[model samples]
Target chain A: MTATTDTTRDRIDDALVRLTPAQVTIAVLTIAALGFVLLFAQEPMVHDSLHTFRHAAGITCH
Target chain B: MTLTDHLVRGLKAGAVAGGAYGLFVALIGNPLIRYAETFEHSHSGGGPVVPRAVTALISTAGGVFLGILFGVVVIGALYYFLEPAIPGTDGTKSYLLGAAGFVTVSGAPWLAIPPQPPGVEQALGVETRILWYLLMATVGAFACGLSGYVYTRLRPRYGQAPAGLGAGLVFLSIPVVATIAPANPVSGSLPAELAFVIQAVTGLGQVGLWFVLASAHAWLLRRDRDEERTGYGRVDHRDPTEPLGVDP
Candidate 1:
C-alpha cells in the first residue's frame, strides 16, 4: 500500500513538473499577444485627433 | 535547461507567432476591415464619418484574434519540434510560453487611424495616407514575424543569440533615435513631429517588448525541461519534437 501511494505521488509530482514549462509558455504568449493588440491598435487615431483638436484649440507648436 | 537554450526556444516561438499573426492581419483582417468599411459606406447616405473609435475597436479585436491564432498554431508547432533539440525542453510548455509572450507584447500601443481621414476630401500625399500606415504596420509585423521564423531556424542549427536581442537593439537605438533627432526633414509641423514621436516611442517600446517576449520564450524552454524530468505527458507528444509539423 505504501509503495503504491509513493508511485501515485511520484506520478503527480512528475505531471506538475512537466506542466510548469507549458504553463509558463502559454502565459507568456497570451500576455504578449494581448499586449500587442492593446497597445498598437487604438493609439494612432487618438494621438492624431488630439493633435488636430489641440491645433484647432489654438495650441501652437515649434 | 540553460539560459541559452531557453532563449533560443523563445526566439523561435516569437518568430512563428509573430509571423502568423502578421500574415493573418494583412491577409484576413485588412480585407475584413475594408469590406466592413465598404458596407458602411454603401448603407449610410453620406455616413457620419465612421469614427476612429469604431474603426480602432474593430481592428484591435481583429489583431487580438490573429495574435491568439498565431500563438496556437505557428508558435505551438515550433515549440513542439524544437523542444527536443534543446536538452530538457517540453513541447507543451514552449507553446504556453510563446502564447503568453505573444499576448503580452501584442497590444503595447493603442491607436488607430481610418483609411480615409474624416472630412478630408482631397487625398493627402500617398505617404501620409491611412492605407500607407496600415501597409507600414503590416510590413513591420511581417518583418517581426519573419525574424521569429529566422530565429528558430538559426538557433539550434548555429546555437546563436535570440534574434529579438538584435532586433531590440536595432529598433531602439537607430530608427527610434533617428526620429528624435532635431530637424527631421520628413516631418514639418509640431503635429507631424508629435506623430513622428509616437512612431519613435512605439519603435523603442517594441525593443523592450521583444526583449520581454524573448524572456517568455526562455521561461517556456526552462519549463519544458522541467516537464521532461517530471514525465508530464503532452496532448500531442509525437510531433512535439519535430520541426514545422502540422498540429493534430
Candidate 2:
C-alpha cells in the first residue's frame, strides 16, 4: 500500500466533523433570539409579549 | 454524543415535562389565579377583568411554552456544554440539579421580592426590581452549582451525609444572605391568608415542573442512548428527519 498525503478536502471534512450542522444552526439561532430579547426587553417598552408567561410562571411583575 | 443530539433529546424532554407542568397549572394553578384575581378585586376595587376562561387558557399555554424553553435551553443546551467539564455522566444527580434550579430561579428571587398580588403597588421601581431579581437568581444559581462541586470534592474525604450537609448549608446561605435585600411593597388589600395560598400553590407548581423536567429528561436520555452514539459518529450531521424524541 502507498502512503497518501492529506488534502484540502480532508482538512475541511475534519473541520466540519467537530460540530453537526444542526448544532451550528441551533446555536446561531438561539444566540440571535436571545440577543434580540436582551436588547429590547425593557419596561413600558417594546411589548408585553410574555405578560401571561410572567404571571403564569410565578414571576412577580405586579 | 454530539451536543446537538443532547439538545434534541433535551427539547423532547422539555416538551414532555412542559406538558406535565401545563397540566398541573391547568389542574390547580388556573383556579388559584382566578381566586387571587377575585381577592385582588375585592380588596383593591378594580373594574371588570378578563373572564376566567381566558385567564386559564393563557396561563396554561404560557406555562407549557415556558417549561419547554427552560428544558431546551437551560437543561438541554447549557447542560450539554457543561457536561464536558462535569465529571462522569451528565445527569448523575437529577434531583439535586432540579432542586438547585428551583432555588436559583424562583426560591431565591422570591425571597428578594415575593410575588405581588394584583392591584398592588411595588416599593422598588420596575428596573430596580428586575435588576435585583436577575442578580439574585444568577448569584443563587452559581452558589447552588458550586455547592454540587464542593459536595463531590468533599464526598471522599468526609463521606456522603456529612458532605451533603455541609454543601446544603453552603447552598442555603446564599438565599439567606440575599434575604437582606429590600422587599416589594405589599398592598394590605389581599388577605395574608389568601396571599399565602397563592404562594404555596405557585411554589409547589414550580417544584412539580422541575421534578417532571428532570425525570423526563433522564428517561429520554436512557431511551435515546443508542441513537446518540450513532448520531454522533455521523458526518455532515444535518438530518432533517432527525427526531426530537420522547417515549410513550
Candidate 3:
C-alpha cells in the first residue's frame, strides 16, 4: 500500500510539472503574435504611432 | 487545473495590468514628452508634423496595446514555461518573472545606455544601439536564469534563505559585468534636469507595468486556488483511466 501511494504521488507530481499539448499550442501562438508585433513595429506608421511609448518603454528608438 | 488554464489566467491578469499601465502612461507620460519635444523641435527648426494631442492619443492607445502584449508574452507564455522551474508560491513566481522581464528588457540595457529624451543625439546609430540593447538583454536574462538554476541547486542543501541569498549575489554581479560594454555617447539640447525627469518617468512607468502584471497574476492564481478549495470549481488532477506509473 505504501509503495502504491508513493507511485501515485510520483505520478501526480510528474503530471503537475508536465505541459499539456494545449499549453504548447498557446505558447506557440503567443510567441508568434509577439514576433509579428515586433516586426510590424518597424513600419513607419506603426513606429510613429508608438514612438512616445517606445521611449517610455526604454526601447532603442529615434 | 491544467497549465493551459494557468496560461489563460495569466492572459486575464495581463489585460488588467496592461490597462492599468496604459492609463498611467496617458496621465503621467504624455505631458513630459510634449515638453521634451519642444526642445527637439527648436534644435531642428521645424514644428511637430503631428499635433501634440493626436500623437498623445495614439501613443496612449499604443501603450495599452503593448502592455497587453507584454502580459500575454511574459506573464502568459513565459510564465507557463517557467512555472515549474521557478521557486516560491505561484504569486512569488509571478513576481519573480515580472522582475526578470523588467531586468531583461529595461534594466540591463539602461545600464549601458540610459533611455534618451527627444532631441538627444546618440553617438551610435539606432541599429547599433538596438543591437547593443539586445545583447544586454540577453546577458541580463542569462544572469537571472543562472541565478534561478543556482538557487534550485543550493536550495536542497542550504535551504530557502541561504539559497536565495546566494542566487541574489549571482544576480547582483550582472551590473558589474555590464560595465564591460561600451557606453552610448549622448549629446542633446534638452536640459539635464528635464532629461533626468524623462528617464525617471519612463523607468517608473515600466515598474508600474510589471508590478501590476505580477500582482494581478498572483491574485488570479490565488483566486483559482480559493475557488478550488471552496468546491466552487474543483479540478480532478488525476487521470483515473491511466494506470499508475504507466507512461502516457
Candidate 3 off by > 4 Å: A1-42, B42-51, B233-248
Q: What is the TM-score of chain A in candidate 2?
A: 0.42
lDDT per residue, candidate 3, B38-105, as tens digits?
78735324444566667677778777776677787788756755776778877799999999989988
lDDT (0 to 1) per candidate: 0.39, 0.65, 0.76
Docking class of 2: incorrect
Off by over 4 Å in 1: A1-62, B1-53, B79-190, B232-248
The most accurate candidate by DockQ is: 3
Per-residue lDDT tens digits for candidate 2, residues B1-248, read 44566678778878988898878778776666556666554422343355455656755776787677778776776665554333336456455556767888788887787766454556787678777788788878888767777777888899989887877787677767677787666665667887777777778878888888888877777666654556654355455688755422
The list of candidate 2 runs beyond 4 A from truth reads A1-53, B41-55, B84-91, B226-248
Better-scoring candidate (TM-score), 1 or 2: 2
Order candidates by DockQ, high to low: 3, 2, 1
TM-score, predicted candidate 3 vs. hidden true structure:
0.81
Per-candidate clash tally: 64, 0, 0
